[model samples]
Target: MIWLVIILLLLSILLYLLLVPIIVVIDTINNTYYLELKGLAKASVIEDNIEVLKIKMRILFFKFYMYPLKKMAIKKSKKTKVLKPKNERFINSKNLKRVLRVIKSFNIKKFYMNLDTGDYAANAKLYPVFSFLNFYKATNCNVNFVGENNVQLIIQNRPVRIIKSFINL
Candidate 1:
């Protein structure tokens, strides 16, 4: 009877030791799942807000830039040279809309602005760039301003996961 009791106690201890790891693994998985769901919710909210902001920007562009440009082009006719470069002429609101559309179509997961160029813009150009950066930042998107003049923003589909895991200490 004494030996049987000792064997029973040993069995219970062994079972507990074996189950502890399984419980811990289950808890870790649950926590990871919760984090993933939270991340997805955050991403969705950001995407919706970005869409609304883009629409507002398009309206502003049409009202402020495209309509006026169209009027000026009409007034110039074919004889009066506008004297603007062909590229500059093409960089109107329509082109901006197209660029925005492309950016959206790509379903950009991450955004980074590279504004290390030495070129100084007057208030005219400065306002738009500042506004764009503000808009991007407001959307809860990640924006890294690299100090390299030739560096362009790179978008990666899985950047969020990589960044999140990397920053996890």
Candidate 2:
């Protein structure tokens, strides 16, 4: 009788272990909270900690597991921006083009900027430099600011996944 009980316990434990990975996937996909500050800021594709992924199914929901997230929140920000620094000149299309060209040359994968007010963040993506520059000129004046006295540029590129090759098609 005791041997049968031990075998049953072992089988239950194995079943639990097999189900854990499924639970984690469901939790991340279903329970994720996207706090969007559209006019202020927004976040997309936030990365989770690898350790949380390794956590036991029971303790994964604990507060300690959720700590250490890299988040820029408005209420927590204290650093004040010195309204327009001296060296930072107004961005013009010609000058902005030069800077973007340099950035493209270096092959910068990610660029991030947050407002001093701490309520906004600009996530800009640039790809294929020559075409982008041409598009900018076509939509805006060649002499002064690109659009509306402020150079408003938008670049759309597909999100890259590093592990796509490893996954079977």
Candidate 3:
């Protein structure tokens, strides 16, 4: 009877240890799924907002260039350059301010903008204030760019050092 009771106690301890890890894994999966769902929802909203902005741009351009004054001016002289209004030229400025306000209100921990080589031409179009804010916020930062199987970090215009001290050189 003594041996049987000891064996049963050992089995209970083994089962508890095994079940604890299973519970932890399930909780981790639940949290990951929740975060993924939230990311998808945010992406969808951003996509919709971009489509709306495109529509607004189209309407503004048509109203500015297709108006009666524009037609009369074109008939009068073909040399006049029909330029966009100052406010229309600065539409992106307002949008950038709105984005910065949202970022500040939410207290974003990190911000990233992925631009291709061709995008250099549009750097002039970005708001100077937004660029300044980004630079100010980037102080004491760790930025990593992972491409394919290569990982690199840029720290203050220098590459981060990777050390393996355990191995002899």
Candidate 4:
């Protein structure tokens, strides 16, 4: 009856959240980097001081600033000696394949990079590799011999795909 309707509504909302794509945008030239979940939440690196940079997160109408170094300092001040469990993760061919699958799930929405290797011969060799990627509308890659480096990448993936990747493991 009413309970069934409410449960269905909740399940639909959960599915929407799990299926919605999370976007990660990074642009070194303009110094913009952020992770966004459509209209729900966004976290971006922002610098208020010349030396210290903080992460600013916005959820709904609320804004929060997180200082990374301050939290680490507070953790160091605590005297609690908690034994952490030994990490069992190791790099192997099998584990590497799993990691590759997880990375492949992400869709490259946009990618642009300009690289210079300082040596003209090295730059000439890499030019064709980057030029080949330029055939795709989503990518704009090039190599310069003028010693300038720039990168901009935008990728999106759904939580469900990430969960599935691990669940299969």
Candidate 5:
């Protein structure tokens, strides 16, 4: 009856959310880095001052700011010795490959970069490498002689896809 209808509605909403893609945008040209869950929430890093950076999150009509770099007062306390666990697992080559595969699942929406190494010889050496990458990938990679370094990248992946990747691993 009414309960069944409500449950169905909630399930549909959950499915929609899982299907929605999460986007990551990085723009060094504007010094903006943000993660966006389409139509739901956005979190961005912003500079509070010359040396301080803060995270700003916006969900619908509400906005919040978090200062991760803010200094906190520390009180003197006794130091305790920490012991390492015996069953600790290190990331071997196999696990590293799996992690890389998961990252490769993300779709690149846009990619552009302009790099300057300050040395003319280095720039000359990098020009061929940049040209080769640009030809193979959907990216605008450039080596500039002038003093300019800029990058803008936008990538997205659905939650379901990420979950599927993890499951495969």
Candidate 6:
């Protein structure tokens, strides 16, 4: 009886460990995403290699997401620090069928604008603020434009699924 109980406990522990990857899959399916970094900060994308770490299941229809990138990213980035990253926001106004999230933002700075082409990049400070309120200083963010002509928009640090969208097209 004692040996059987010990074996059961070990099995449960293994199951819990496996849930991390499953949670990532579920959140990836449920959420919509985008990436945007205004300017010279945009160049940082060349060095980015982000990945999903985990997810928090709050309710059947809602979840609290988490990323750990402070030491690995924010502190390392030369531009745009203390950015406000939000995750619970939805993408389409007409359809709750899909969800959208902002993911990350950078500290404000000035960038050269190419008004005719409508594409320009900005330059931010060398150091980041590292604010506690900035999603507890996490990482795995990105920068890009998203959405369609009907509901056009721009955002940052979207999920891998959102990024894969362009490749499919």
Model 6 segments more than 4 A misplaced: 23-169
TM-score pick, better of 1 and 3: 1
On TM-score, who's better, 3 or 6?
Answer: 3
Specify the poorest-scoring 10-residue window by lDDT in model 6.
38-47
Ranking by TM-score: 5, 4, 1, 2, 3, 6
Alpha carbon RMSD to native, model 5 = 2.2
Model 3, residue 15: C-alpha shift (Å):
31
**In the order shown, what is each candidate's alpha-carbon RMSD?**
25.4, 18.5, 23.8, 3.4, 2.2, 21.9
**Which has the higher TM-score value, candidate number 1 or candidate number 5?**
5
TM-score against native, each model: 0.21, 0.21, 0.19, 0.79, 0.88, 0.18
- Highest lDDT scorer: 5
Using TM-score, give the best candidate's number. Answer: 5
- List, in order, the clash count of every candidate structure: 0, 0, 0, 0, 0, 12
Q: What tens-digit string does per-residue lDDT give for candidate 5 at 1-169?
A: 9999999999999999999889999999999999999999999999887548899999988999988877789887798779878785698887887898789889999999999999999999999999999999989999998799999999999999888887885
> Model 3, residue 109: displacement in angstroms?
1.4
lDDT of 2 at 163: 23
TM-score of 5: 0.88
lDDT: worst 10-residue window of model 2: 20-29
Clashing pairs in 4: none
Tell me the tens digit of each residue's lDDT in model 2 across 30-109.
34323222222222333455533222112333322233343546585588767855785689776666655433432222
* Clash pairs for candidate 2: none
lDDT of 2 at 142: 23
